[model samples]
Target: MKNFKTLLFITLMGSLCLTAQNNDTKRADKEFARFEYVDAAESYLKLVENGKGSDYVYGRLAESYYNIFNTVEAERWYAKALETSNDPEMIYKYSEMLKANGKYKESNEQMEKFASMRPSDNRATAYRKNPDYLPKILEQGKKFNVQNAGFNSEQSDFGGTLHDGKLYITSGRNDSRKTYGWNEEPFLDIYTLTENSDGGYDNPTLVNSYINTRFHEGLVSFAPDGNTMFFSRESYFEKDFEQDSLSRTRYGQLYLFKATKLKDDWDEVESLSINSENYSVKNPSVSSDGSTLYFASNMPGGYGQYDIYKATINDDGTIGEPQNLGQKVNTEGQEMFPFISSNNTLYFSSNGHLGLGGMDVFYTKEIDGKMAPIRNVGIPISSNADDFAFIIDEVSGEGFVSSNRDGGMGSDDIYTIKKLQPLCDVLIAATVLDDKTREPISGANVSLYDDQGNKVVTKSTNADGIAEFIIECEKDTELEVTMDDYESRKVALQGTSDEESPVQISLSPIEKIITPEEIVLNPIFFEYDKSNITAQAAFELDKLVQVMNKYPELVIKATSHTDYIGSDSYNQRLSQRRAKSTEQYVISKGIDESRISSEGKGESEPKIDCGTNCTDEERQMNRRSEFLIVSGGPESQE
Candidate 1:
């Protein structure tokens, strides 16, 4: 999708719709139906200039430019076409143009209109479900910390490669060159940069003129030794391309060329033998050993418009036939800018797969002699605009990526990428012992909970009374410890450290009381609207578990309750699930299921009479799990 073709005579998806067939419009119809979009666009503009333009002519012109990805012109004509037309598809296309130009609010307006017209369409239904999705997309998770490269320009600068303290990039910074019809920008050229010790960059200078022509040239990749370089150039430089007979148009394809870095300058620039007159070959990404060359192509036998293809580098320097990366990497749409890391992971950009609207960067790693599922690199790296050419240093966790997102110095600017530590990485190490005797409590139950109150892991203390877990170092890591006739203990671990310290806990022994009254143990609390036992709750439950184990014939009943946030029926269902979960946990720890029964009290039995006006602390008391002795005490079951 980034190639930005001139669109002379393209391979059409199918025959285009035609409304006029007179001699004047006959030439335009043939060009339009064949998907000669640029030629079609030119002819339609001529008709408009001659005062013979109609709704069909204006619509065809918009569709032609849109197909060729000229959003600037497409937006102009789509606006004109929609003034009197009600075509739902055009509305969707208009929305796409508005989005590509960063007019998201206007885009959503058209999208909502289209969704109302075609309520059954999946794309429309999806847009209607979540029209304001940008904030959520941005907040998904941080994959990279990014900032503008110091050596960017007000033109399209992209395809960054770092080698030996120097940055090699491609850009349209040469204003002396002729403008490209696709984006109305200067043709691409290669540029290099060297950094100074003071963390500043020397101005980016041009590569050798022989390697860069007035035609498009960008995206350079080099060998590990920096002696050999493979890069993309326009096919017009080869002087062996074909032209369409009817249109008499010169079609240019992007091809890969090889050059060697010599003493003072690069020499012996030669086109790769795999160059074809019909298909494109660009975006070269070579291996560190120079044994494998990965590039993007629209050649035959590909699975998509532009698929990532690799050719083996032979010992004698000859190249093998290109191999498509297969359906796992290539889709029915475009895939380009492949980078094979030193660790053997393939990173590429894709638009066919599900993403956050435009091209999102995805990575695929090999496992067991096959490619694994492709994973989106996630937000802060990908956006609604085109994001590609991603590379990262796996060791230092710093690299670069190219994006056309808003607030850049150019249409496509290179952004420096850096990796930061995850939000959490705290390890939990806990120990349980008697408070007075200072003796280790063996086989004591311990549970770990994350900051979100999720039961992450559960383990029992060993002979040394230790339970350790490596978790995301978070704000509120809770640990629970309990033993027979001992007061339940709960401890919260919170700090940041590369090394974790053991959370030592001590429990006090409780006096044995023989009474006919049931002992109301402290409330085993849960997070809001949750049923699973937390680390704190687990500590309290373990006490009852130990007491029941001592008195083998003892029976207990657990009643769970919820606050006034939900409906009566729903809260009853939720509390029932909570009670069942608690009972199951006790049974799993060597207790008989028949000795434990559970019931849901819902919000009807709130001990805090504050009711609906209850504070969070008061609500916490309401959402409780209580245990009562039913039998095997001095008294019988009621």
Candidate 2:
């Protein structure tokens, strides 16, 4: 009877302990899901102390530390999680944490494992392509000379934007306000540092009392006229929130708000039409022209967790539909804090694209209304910890960026950025046009060649008839322009000083008469008594290649003729060589060999028919190659 009672007591205690653990797990999970990471970490730590460690628990614990930017704790828990968990994302995050802790080699080892597991992932592909990218990034040297902005507090302070002699920023130094569960910091508020007479910033002050609410608010963007403003704030300001299931823990999203300047202070504060209760819309940046509004959101139909989006700011001060920046500018990870410069370069922060780690600042210019290739802004602006909120001025070569990198005054601090180098080594903007019409010509190929005549770079003319190139400034180069049915033009690349002038190229259309039987191009001229193709001949032959490429099924016969200046046999041999050369050249330009046939007509099919008494001009016309469309003709796919 005593043994039975002891066994029953032991079993009951075990049940009670399991129930308590289960309750703790549920609470921690809920806190984590609601982004209450500080509380979640504490609750999860209790589980670890009670010997209830699991792969899932370890992963959650590591993520909680990572979200709060605690690299040491995150790395420890991640190492524990990786002992049993094979999740690729967890491994990737662990690698990032390792990097933050200065364990690059270990991070790379884990990244290699991650790449093998998920080769198709963008992060994995980027790692595979440039596994040793860190040294190269450091070797590229610093583009920006950085310094502490000097207004940092003991708490989180970031998102600096300079406008009209004032530096605007977000700060969590309001000790009186409620502390956020994510970081245990006071709610964010907008503050500005006014420029003093000595050209340095003065002490910080709240931009407006109403704009600084009890909930989070900051990251302000002003219109071009400075009369209007756009900023981010928690939806809680309008009593907006969502209750999550039975827990009923209220969740508030960041929403974009617009306000109008009423003389000394901003008034008429209202949320923008793009704001929604389902997701977040923050980090507003108005274009230089104020025609477009750029922002970041995690709204539905996005390519990733959060994506950079843009909307047309209509003249009536209403926003059009928000359009995602697409895969080139966005990824399957978070992209946020978009800032558009005066030169149309869009700078944003993302961890998704190839970077040093965490959220690195990247820039892409708008080319012909499309986003150009995204490029990392490089070291000093990026780090292993969260680095974001980049803003710049093209003219001044000065800017500011927010970072949580090592040796910072607080969790996030603002740093001043001075560009160390000029924009592009040498910038050339070339414009192609028609010689006869003098109108902008689109779809023209513009190529840059060095002094040695080696082709350097080539670009197709955009809709604006412009092809821009950034090349070495000191080297002498040549610009060559070519089009389908136009004469090729070459001009020497001239060096200019500070002032920029567009290089204009005019090309004459290839004069041709297309008949049902044969396509007659401008006379193909070779040096006198030679069968080799000349530059002029090559130029005219390009037109034939275009026509053949356009109509793949078209078959042409090349027949060469010569003047009556030489013996019959000699002229026949020369014509034969010329005809074969023409056929071979066309084939070399990606045309099918079976589609073209060649023959030598000698002087029998001369256009002039002047015989031995022909003048130089008439004889030149007689010496030509005729493209006779035998099977497929112009009417098929013209």
Candidate 3:
């Protein structure tokens, strides 16, 4: 997540400092040990071309490229190494590279391999919980409202650290410095700006000449004396570096420095004792008491490329031996830019741990002296790009995060972040009406239940047959309306946002019988000449089924008719098929077959008799079906 000059890294394992018997292979190992991955990659290729390659060489070569964030080269050698070795760490690293290159399906394969070997790993556990975490990150809402800082420059600017009401930041605004190869931008320098009375910022002024260098400098944290400050600086200042023998090139690592604030500037600069020529120790953060300093480093014996470390800052200005913050806060990827808040909560940015996309800001508070699970700050503060260097004023609930995402003036930019309140719940409402008369039914009991059948709210319909409810957004809600003699009805309610729509419920009257001689009802139409019963026909048949069930001693005869369009025999067969289908459908709904019979009227008994000169409407009327109760008629039931 931390990229460019700010990020630091080391080999996957300290034990990877392999010494080969051959001089050529030894040369490659030394280059990798010195962290010259580009040169080491070439040296390793020479050994493989010269027929002296092994899984150890390939794995270390892959790790060399990985440390440089060269995922393409990393994946190549990792694949080659897989032919010879099955190291779980190799699989994990390969999975990360594959995912970085957008090969998620293959990455999951590698992750499964790693999980089978090391099932207890936290990374494995996180992957098992969510093999698809990208969408969850994309779906997450913005964690903070962000805007541009008044003091942002027209070049790469980031790392906003607030100290004594003044904001110190890192920038590549100085064109005088050499262009850094990482982004073809000028090397970084420390800049300071004071807050204006109107919540604006004064024009930034570069820090005192002594505290900066021709290479790069990161953000800073000040001690209680305000004179003592600690920050990240490139080791080139003192020629503290390692040389690649094969290429005759020197690479400087990152180091932490302590400086004293003189009048209007910072001076008395001195590199910390923990600074190493073999590895990087950068990104400094200080406790409020100034007795402890937290930083990120790639020193040997750490859990990963960059691990958070803590050191005791003694009164003599020297620091105690740095201790790795432990695996709980470190992983196999970059974790840097730590800030210890006034309340002792440790906040940092990491890509090694599970998070949104790229580098996400995370916080962990001490619980009984142990750090809790690192919680992501989420989006708006984090993104799919580099998001680091988060510091805040807890009282104001305002902070700043550095990012190289879109809309930036340069490579990386600092944004003012403010926390906002969450949104409100959805409103659900319903209306009840009589089914037959289509009239509003007042004083009806309406109950709302969630998808789990838990009752949420209950109310009676008003004079307008409306029952309103305010509820939280859930998967589905059932709105039930019931009256004394009408059958109860329920309607489902659902939405994606805080929207309200009234559900219309119609309760039918529980009538047991209809006109027995000629039951007049809504027509149930069928598809052209088809014997299959339609849903509308089934609904009409349900009324008969309910009536028949109400009076068990009832017997009914169904008669079907058709227009005179086809041959008489064909017409007769079609009508008979319709009659049989209706009879079968009724019997399927629990009606006794022995108590029901059917007949085909064909074109003989037409409801609208116009001979062969019949209009389409007359023909439609002639094609119909009727049900008559022979035994338990309406008069008999009455």
Most TM-score-accurate candidate: 2
Model 1 C-alpha lDDT per residue in residues 1-638, reported as the tens digit of each score: 43445342232311232333255688888876654555677898999999877678889889876654567788889989899889999999898777766677798899999999999999898887677745544554585798988678888989778776777898898889899878999998888888888665667888888788888897888877787888999999988677899999888888899888788667789899899988999999888677999999999998889999899988876789998888989999999999987766788999987688689887776543456556667677887789999987767878889999989998898998886743223445687888898988888888775554545456778898887775544356777665667766667777554535677898877434224544456776666665655545655666777777666778888888888998999998888867866775576466877898888888989979886799999988887777777888644533
As a whole number from 0 to 100, the lDDT of residue 297 in candidate 2 is: 94
Error of 3 at 503 (Å): 43
Give the per-residue lDDT of model 3 (tens digit) for 344-378: 77889999877766898877765434565566676
Q: Please say which candidate is ahead in TM-score: 2 or 3.
A: 2
Q: Could you give me the TM-score of model 3 versus the true structure?
A: 0.47
User: Order of all candidates by lDDT, from best down to worst?
Assistant: 2, 1, 3
Segments in model 3 whose C-alpha atoms lie over 4 Å from true places: 1-140, 421-638
Q: Give the Cα lDDT of each candidate.
A: 0.77, 0.82, 0.77
| Candidate 2 C-alpha error for residue 395, in Å | 2.6
Backbone clashes in model 1 = 6
- On the 0 to 100 scale, the lDDT of residue 527 in model 1 is 64
Better of 1 and 2 by TM-score: 2
Give per-residue CA lDDT, model 2, range 127-240, as digits (tens): 887787666556544878988888798899998787777788999987888898899999899998988776667688887766887788979998999989999999998888
Indicate the residue-level lDDT of 174 in model 3. Answer: 91
